[model samples]
Target: MRRHARERPEAVALRFLADGEDVVTEWSYRQLIQRVSSISRRLAEAGARGERVILLYDSGPEYIAAFMGVLQAGGIAVPTYPPMGQRPLSRLIGIIQDAAPRFVLSTARTRDTQARRVAELSGHGALEWVASDELPTRESYEDVPVVQDQPLAMLQYTSGSTGSPKGVMVTHANLLSNCETIARWLGPSEGRRGGMWLPLFHDMGLLGGVMQPLYSGFPLLFMDPMYFIQRPVRWLRAISKHRLTLSGAPNFAYELCATQIPDDELQGLDLSCWSEAFCGAEPVRSETMQRFAARFAPYGFRAEALSPCYGLAEATLLVAGKPAGTRLRTFVSPRQEDGGEASPEAPRELVSSGRVVHAHRVRIIDPDTLAECPPGKVGEVWVHGPSVAMGYWGREEESRQTFQATLPDGPAGYLRTGDLGLLHEGELFISGRRKNVIIIAGRNHHAEDVEQTAEAAHAQVRKGGVAAFPVTAGNEERLVLLVELKPDGRRTEAEVAAVREGIIQAVVAAHGVRPHDIFFGSVGAISRTTSGKLQRQTTRQAYLGGVLPALKVAP
Candidate 1:
């Protein structure tokens, strides 16, 4: 970074729009290097190198600089999303307890607005808040960077499927290795301008979006995620206007563009410059890929540019990605992957996520026997490489269980992804998470499969707003389904009851087991992590606690 600043002092490294202003805040390489120097000084004054430092800033250049500063200062950066909406205090308390950081860096605006929430979380400790912008810049600055004695760099908390968040202990070497691997896969297109709206707290947003550009020497543009949520078309417009060569989001974001963006609203939009539309951080639905490609086809969005990727935070954000400038291959058949057998069922298209990146090896293994599966057979996905984190912080046994798994015939121990998938023609295809499999009458059923059936049963129910989990009923584990209804008030109560009926009948017909309980709720009732992935365990906790504001409950 210092080298870049010295070489191209005026070059824009990152750009973000100011609040309510048409003007943008530019962080030139020179200015960014200076800000980083100031941040390092503040950290040096407060504590030692290996201590944890939390970041709770709004989207801007300062946040990005502070994150780099943490690395430069030799502190482990824990990037956290600012709390919003109801029960914001409770939202951060768990993370606070888990992180146990000595200092939190934030802006004055965030401190003043969220004082109460901060106080509540810090009541259990003596945590300090360091003002990032108020820190003084040194009069004389040399490009001599801070020396690192420890291997640890950052602690990326995982989005847990069945429990509270676990901090993945990431080292400095891990970040560099993973960034280089991702840079190779994403490629350095002719004009390497990157633009994305994914939240900074997400691994994709931070590691892939922020770090990749810096590693690859590309200019990046960031927009407030809330802005994109308010208007999805702005994402494309940003790419179109900026002539961005790369940008991406989850599968749901693509589905939103296809369904919500009307024809007239897409006037004068051109997406031809977007050569790499890397989609990951969640399940990449084939229907979503097809819809988005078809919707933007007239605007010069090539079918070959529709890239679907597969990764996890445990692997430092990227495991495998489709190579650039190639079309994806998919299979449409009524087959349940990971089960090792074909079944008569509803057919769905499964898109190939291409190959694993440089130096990273991926294996599909039988979970029980720890044996590798063949090219076309489904099994658990295991990752082995330098990009994998050391282990989870403060949880030795838990970390060992998840991060240290061995294959019976393989030499290298692999990081068990806990995700189910298959390798066909050397390409990866994810099936689902292992913990999310719902068993009914001794038959294995993926929760995603059941949720898809429920979402397709009624037009009133919002897609991607359904969660399927199991709850103990009598002596057996019975399925519990939660569906989010559309926000429109036109759907009557009787109509809602009929929708519930339709959902139950559809699940029974498809999965061969009826849900013991069904709950209908408003749009935001379904819980999600900061990265926008489904928090099924939290939703189950809410359901069991009777806190779910259900419009109607049926048994």
Candidate 2:
């Protein structure tokens, strides 16, 4: 960092954009390192090395500087997305309780504005509040800075799309190694320029958006996530106007731009210069990739630019990435893995997530037998590499269960990704989560397959707003469906009943399994994690507890 500061003092290392075209803040390489050093000194004064510091911020350049400062000061940074509106964020609260941080770091504006809420949070006797901007900036170097085997660097909280979030412990070696791996795998951007609109609190956004630029010595443009959400076209505009060589988002973001943007809005756009548009963080739907590429083809987007990747917080962000310009590999699973009998219509389309990146070695193993699965067969995905995190903080048993697994004949321990996928021609194709597979009678169906089918059954149902899970009834697990109806205040009960029937019939026709019960709910009834993936099991809990509000299909 100091080397960059000296070599390229005035080069723009970071830029934060708010609204759309406005540049709210920016930091040069020298300025960024200076701020980091100053904050490091302040942190050293207040907290001991290896102590946990809770970071609460909506957005700002200070967030990035302070995040780096925590590591420089030998403190573990725990960045959290501060609640935006009225009702308290239960997820943030849960994380806070679990982290049990001694110091809470926030921007001065956040500290002043969220007075009452901040009071409620910091009222805990042992917790201390640390304002980022107010921290003293005396450049004091540590006697022993970053030993070969130092303590853990940060605790990244999982997105909790499936269950309660756990803190993935990331050591210094793990952090630096993953950043290097990302650079080597993806290659450096043109002029070392990149842009991202993903929320900084998420692992992808943090690593790829913020840390990657610093680690690789590049300029990064970041816009507020809300602005991008309000207008997905803004993302493409930023990439084009900036001539970014690298940028990415979750699969749903690409789908939004493909489906929601009108031709008029897309006019005069040029994305020819944007290369290596990495997409990951959730299931990379094949249709989404195709639609996005076709939609932007006239505007200079290339299919090879559609880099489909796979990763998780436990792996410190990236695991696999496709080579530039190589199209995704497609395969059809056998009828047994396809959830029904053998027939021409039984083949399900699955897309490859490219190949494993750097030193990461991925394998498919039978979940119960612990034996490696043959090629073209779907099974649990295991990863072994330097990028794998130390373990889940404070959850030793879970850490062991997830991060430590023996293949008997193969490697001693591998990270049980909990994801089901197949390896073909050295490329990885992720199917779905093992816990998320809805087994009905004898057939196994991925939740995504079921949910997409239900959403497609009716016009009134919102796209990407269906949750399918298995609920135990007596001794057997029965399929339960939750459909989010598009907001129509005056819609009659009969219409909802028709929609429910449509969903059930579609599932039966597609997968040959009828849901045990179908509940019609209003828009936004389905809960998503902080990173915006649907929480199926969480929704199931709400349904079983009799608290999930559902529209009456029949009056």
Candidate 3:
């Protein structure tokens, strides 16, 4: 990266728009190398080398500098997302405890908030909290490049299915390989102008927003994640204004922008330069992509710019992506793909996530036997490549399970992505997750299936009332359902009674299991992750908190 920066030192490395001014932050290869060297020396002098440093800062030039500084100093950089509120602060502290970092780096504005929380978690002794503003400025130093295969980066806790968050250990090689692969996939014809509003803590933000630009020497346009959430239109406006060539988001983001951005606001926005709009981190819905493209088409948004990619923190971001300048693909079936059903003729839908990016090898395999499934057959998706992480930090068991796999034809090794999908005609189509599958009496049913059924129960159910999760009782698995009542609806005994009955009957008929427990609540009471995935553990926690209203169940 330092080498690339040196070669293109005069290039606009980062473009940070602050307070309506386009601040073109140019870093000629020489300047970046100098900055990194100075920062690394400062970090080393601060007793930070060979230890992990927790970065509690927002996305900006300083954040990038500190990140590169950590790498240059041979320390692991664990960048965290800004705490949402008090609750999330506690969660962040828990993550800090798990990571056991030597120091916590933050700006003055964030110092108190971060220090107070770290103190609470560590009983005021676990780590030294250093404000980035307080770090002494060093005059100069020579650039020191660390070994490529060394563990130099740490992606701190992003919650997955399990409520407990663990840091993903990303080596320098893992990061550089993925970045180079993404650069190649984007091609030289398409100017690699990255435009993103994802939080820097996220893999997409750190790798795609920062490292990709650094490695490729491409210009990046970044904004606070809050800016995008508060006014999603700004994201599109930025892209249009900058004539950004590359951008991306999870599925919910596209939906948010499409729903939030008013038609009139989109009128004069010219988005013709927009290309390689990658989508991932959540289920890529074809309908959402179509709506976004159709709505922004008048403003020069091309359908071919949609890049529905697949990746995870374990892989250091990208695993597989649709080819550049192509629409995303989706395989649809009117009926569910049953386990026993053979050679099912389901209607295939081409939504195009773009072609696979670079040297990554992807395959669909039977979850239990690890046998390769034929193309178009729904099974677990597996990926193998240089981008795959060393493993979860200090989690040998999980690392073994997630990163070890045996192919029928060859040596025993591959990343077993718990995601369920199929490869059709050389393209990957993700269906859902394997762990999310609910099995009742030896029959497998996807959670979406039950959620859909509960939603269709009645008008009230459709509003917001349903969640089905697999619950294990002694050795048998059962489904536990929770439903939230309409906000304005009466919570009287009579109303609760009817609603409970309707939900039970609806779920039993649709999923063949009467929920072991049924709880009712007001609309919007159900908690969800920032990405819009239902927070089952949070809901369970709320239920345990005695906040949910109990309704009489039919015998």
Best by TM-score: 1
Q: Which stretches of candidate 1 lie over 4 Å from their true place?
A: 19-21, 138-140, 160-163, 338-346, 437-467, 470-555
121-227 per-residue lDDT for model 1 (tens digits)? 55744777787888876544475358478688888875421124568898988899999898788766447899978878768889998988887778999888878
- Model 1: worst 10 consecutive residues (lDDT sum): 337-346
| Stretch of 10 with least lDDT, candidate 3 | 336-345
| Candidate no. 1 TM-score | 0.79
Query: Largest lDDT belongs to which candidate?
Result: 1
TM-score of 2: 0.78
Model 2 stretches with alpha carbons more than 4 Å out: 86-88, 115-123, 136-149, 161-163, 188-190, 336-346, 436-555
Worst 10 residues of 2 by lDDT: 336-345
RMSD of each: 10.0, 9.7, 9.9
Q: What lDDT tens digits, residue by residue, belong to model 3 across residues 56-76? A: 777776787778878877778
Estimate the TM-score for candidate 3: 0.77
lDDT of 2 by residue, 1-555 (tens): 666777878888988786666665778887787777777777778864678887788766888888888888888899886766422244465677777777777877776766466447535456677787886554433332542344698999865322244789988888888999888987755575789888787888998778888888888988878888789999998888888878988777888888889899887789998877888776676777888898899999998888888888889888888876787677776641321112232355677888898988999888877888899887888999998998998999988898988776777558988888889898898765666666443234668777878889999888787999876553234689988888777788888778888988887766657899988776667878899889876677678777888764435
TM-score of each: 0.79, 0.78, 0.77
> Comparing candidate 1 with candidate 2, which one achieves the higher lDDT?
1
